[model samples]
Target: MSTPLDIASLIDRERIRPFQWTIFLLCFATTLFDGFDTQAIAYTGPAIVAAFNLAPGDLAPILIAGTLGMTIGAMTLGLVGDRVGRRPALLGGVALFSIASLATAFASGTSQILVLRFIAGLGMGGCTPVLLALAAEYGPARHRGAIMTGVLLGLPAGAMLGGLLAARMMPVIGWEGVFVIGGAAPLALLVLLWFALPESLHFLVTRAGNDQHAVRHVLARIVTWPLADDARFAVHEAAARASVAALFREGNARNTVAIWAVYFFNWIAWFMFLSWLPTVLKASGLPAAQAPLGTVVVNAVFIVCAIPLSIALPRISTRRLLIALLALGIAIAIGLAYAETSWGLVFTLAGAAGLGIGGQQIALNYLVVGAYPTTLRATATGWAIGMGRVGAIAGSAVGGTFLNMGGPGGFYLTLAVPLAAALLAVIAIRTNEPEAGTSLATAAH
Candidate 1:
């Protein structure tokens, strides 16, 4: 008789195959568009302000609405993936956001923009944790850090692309044209996703009364050879019922809280940079035309730093690495406080901030994904991201205040406190590495 299959072990032990890479690519594409939708408002802020006859502070509600919507989606739709399956939840999110993006172009007033952005936020926010979970689940345990980090890179990549595109297009087509492009590309992608993306085999195996044959079929694509029809599959998790409450059960409460605290604090500073950087750069004496350069420089450097940092993560201690990144961020923020009109110095400091703050947030995602069992993975990621959205909202709102009150120097100085708090949170969380000598098969059981 053929040996029964342990699904988690089979995945963990196997080298990554084409199909798994395909899934990662699909998830990456989703996130790329997500980044575009999320940051497009910031890119168009000046145009919007001029069109609407508003002050810099007026944009705060628009910025906060998107993230607040994200908070709700992360908390709610994140669970939908677990209840139904990742494929459907992801597809739904993509469609929702794409449609909302198109509608945002036609927005007539602040009320319409706020409502539409919230709607778009629901889709974009919901997709992130699901994609993160999919990437983590499909990736081999040995290289999970690299795989998930690779997916995380999609966000910055999209941001940089949007920056470039917005720069080129805004001169000709105006800000509304940017939204049209953002909305349309993903809608075209949706068809590809419908055909190309496969459901997570790990999720299938974990489902109660799951179709073992279906799991076997998906596995056949992942493994080198066909499985016998009679082979059994299993995902090892304690039989505690799966629910949101389970996130707080069995000592998970501490881990969940730590993850939330890290995301919340880190995002406060990060979004402050994203939502306000261009305006601040302009105020700091960079030419009005060149302000967008600052935003692009930060995103470009972030993309460059994230790849190497992710690759090195498997070799170094995650907690220590994150703490170091946060410390570097604090130091960079101080430098930025003093940076003046020399565009060269401003760009350099922005890049450093990217390396410090942006890199730490990516590493934090890796930690959150690794902290939970398969059952609660999506929910845990969503909740942590949700809590972070609260910070993002605060950052967006406070950004206006910073610009109005202290200017760039005061704003940069304020970032240090949050970075320090996030560092402390990283120190407080325990690393949940696989126990020594515990093989994938043994650990799953």
Candidate 2:
């Protein structure tokens, strides 16, 4: 008689293997480049404006194009991952962005830049949810939250790298050189992914065209076991077809709506701060050269704190932690409005706020990925991130208006509204338990 093996149990039971680490690292690298390219336009924005002799508002279309593309890509390509495969979807997205970034270097007009950026956004946006799903699937349940957050940390790290490279390389080779490097690095990574990146074992088994041979090969590497030709593999989760409506079925409706709400409002506050903080800092008496440091401090603090936060995620309730983080952000936003013009005070407050908002964003990823079955993981994560991208667009669009109406104090005060709403949404989530080691199969049913 052939022996039956549960794929989820096999992954959960094994010690962390080198193969799994490789997957995590690759996913991390992908996100790192994703961040770099995503922010490439921002880093190059001034250069583009100067190069083209364009009006101030002319760049808005170029900026918004990429984000708009990302929103659509996340919602649609995420479904592609569910139906086709993670490996292919990821490869395709990387290819799309790489080519787009490379092409951006050759653009002659603002129109060309706008279209190329939108195309690049599609790839970057699609990759986020798929990579998250891929990394989470490979990770052992005990360490899943840490692995996902670790991968996500690359976004900020890459953004920081883009800033450094833009400062250094633009001086040497000019702005076009920045895009050239961004496009080339990922093209190199694409070759490695083709050779080394494996399709998700869970995806292989659960997908309609089950590829048992591929599953056995990947399983052997992870488990280091010899398997019989007659051996059978299965996932313990309840059957779920990959579809948008499936997100609302199977008792998932409440969690889905709440997760979407949290993502939407949290990003509204986040992008608002990211978009306008430098201007706000400058207006509050800081020099233009030093103003950008406030944003850097925020990202750096979050990157540093991510380590301990990841450690604590498995031990505590993600829901409660997220709520606390949002509350902290709310308080900090209010405090920021009343803070003195001292640079030290402003940077300090910004860092503290980054800890709260940035930490909450990662915790939301941990919560959402664990809430769905293997079949719907990519789709669910994709849609939530897509919704967040929409919120980002909204925040970025309205930030100028807020600054005009309220100045620094008003801008900061307005930020608190979104954080408060996000806190309420998180509080409404009914699944309050730590998701580690729990079978989502049972939870879904």
* TM-scores for every predicted model: 0.85, 0.81
lDDT of 2 by residue, 69-161 (tens): 888788777799988899999999999999999999988888998899999999998998789888888877767766777898898787767
Score each candidate by Cα lDDT.
Answer: 0.80, 0.79
For candidate 1, write residues 69-130 as lDDT tens digits: 88788777768998888889999999999999999899999889889999999999899978
The candidate scoring highest on lDDT is: 1
TM-score of 1: 0.85
* Model 2 misplaced regions, further than 4 Å: 49-58, 206-209, 241-260, 276-295, 314-324, 334-341, 365-386, 404-410, 424-445
Please give the TM-score that candidate 2 achieves against the real structure: 0.81
